[model samples]
Target: MKEFMTNNDYHDIGFNGPNYTWCNNKEGLARIWERLDRIWLNSKSIMDLSNAVVKHLPRISSDHCPILLQIENKKMHNNREIRFKNMWCSYEVAKGIIAKS
Candidate 1:
């Protein structure tokens, strides 16, 4: 898995709200939990989806838990608006610039 991830330039998208995804469904000492489900992304995907995240859902009628991915879909700011601080208005230069712009 390490070699595969390295070779493919893939990285794990870690989860929140759960430590493991799979369970043996046994009682006490016999029970076992493991992170069997995973989500991987390449460098390009990671860069494109900058705010991507994973979430783990509650398991029901199954030993393996479900997984979810949440991503922020913000468009690239090519023409972002300029914001001026309130304190900058105190300066003459800032007042001139603000007036000019």
Candidate 2:
């Protein structure tokens, strides 16, 4: 796994909340906990999503905890269309610019 990650320039982003993501539903010494899940990203992804965070959610009905990846300070809605006014054709400069295009 380490070799694969190194070759692909991927890194463990780490996590918040619980330290362990997996656990045995046993009592006392019979119980065990381990970090079996992880979140990884490549160098470009790390830079592109600098605000990204990993969080370990509660273990509900399953032995493994759910992980959440959150990205802050991002614009979620960017589907606005660029509209050009037909009135621009009335101006000499706009006509010159439009002709150049």
Candidate 3:
């Protein structure tokens, strides 16, 4: 996590979720529970985005649910459509071939 964050230059870091989301369905002596997932950020992100937070939501299925992220930033324009594209899969020589294909 640290390496990824540092390489990407992310800032704030935190974990938000149920303390124990996983549990074994068994009697007293045989039961086991654990918190398996979490969210993370870095120091620069926290300092730059003061209102960022990760909130734990209600459990729905299995033993765990999802978390809600609240990031306070400038609002987007009403007509804007957000499009995400992954740029890390390109091979230099094959870039044109991949793009055309």
Candidate 4:
């Protein structure tokens, strides 16, 4: 997370929702939970979104939680969309791709 934040120039958006975003749904010593969900934004994007909000939705059937993000001031956002894919990072050559691009 540290490397990704520094390299991608992203800052946490600090969401509002359940404290734990994920869990094994078990009890006793077999149980586990974590705040695995989060939303991040570019520092420059804040200037464009005066009312940006992120919500961590309640856990459902999936093991991972859901996220909802709203940008209230779209007029100034300039249509820039940042996308990240975990699969793209699996390859060893991905570092070069990320660096070169």
Candidate models: Cα lDDT each:
0.90, 0.92, 0.65, 0.80
Question: Model 1: residues >4 Å from true position, as ranges?
Answer: 75-91, 95-101
Reference-based TM-score of each model: 0.74, 0.69, 0.46, 0.62
In model 3, which runs have C-alpha deviations exceeding 4 angstroms?
1-17, 25-27, 73-101
Using lDDT as the yardstick, the better of models 3 and 4 is 4
Clash pairs, candidate 1, are none
Per TM-score, what order, best first?
Answer: 1, 2, 4, 3
How accurate locally is residue 57 in candidate 1, as Cα lDDT from 0 to 100? Answer: 91
Per-candidate clashes come to 0, 0, 9, 0
Off by over 4 Å in 2: 74-101
Ranking of all candidate structures by their lDDT, best first: 2, 1, 4, 3
RMSD of 4: 20.2
lDDT of 3 by residue, 1-101 (tens): 66886788765455466666566656798987766555556666667777777766766766665666788787666896745345634557656656675
Residue 12, model 1: Cα distance from true site in angstroms: 0.6
Backbone clash tally (model 3): 9
Off by over 4 Å in 4: 74-101
lDDT of 4 at 8: 87
Please provide the root mean square deviation of candidate 1 (C-alpha atoms, Å).
Answer: 5.2
Q: Which candidate number has the best lDDT?
A: 2
- Candidate 3 versus the native: TM-score? 0.46
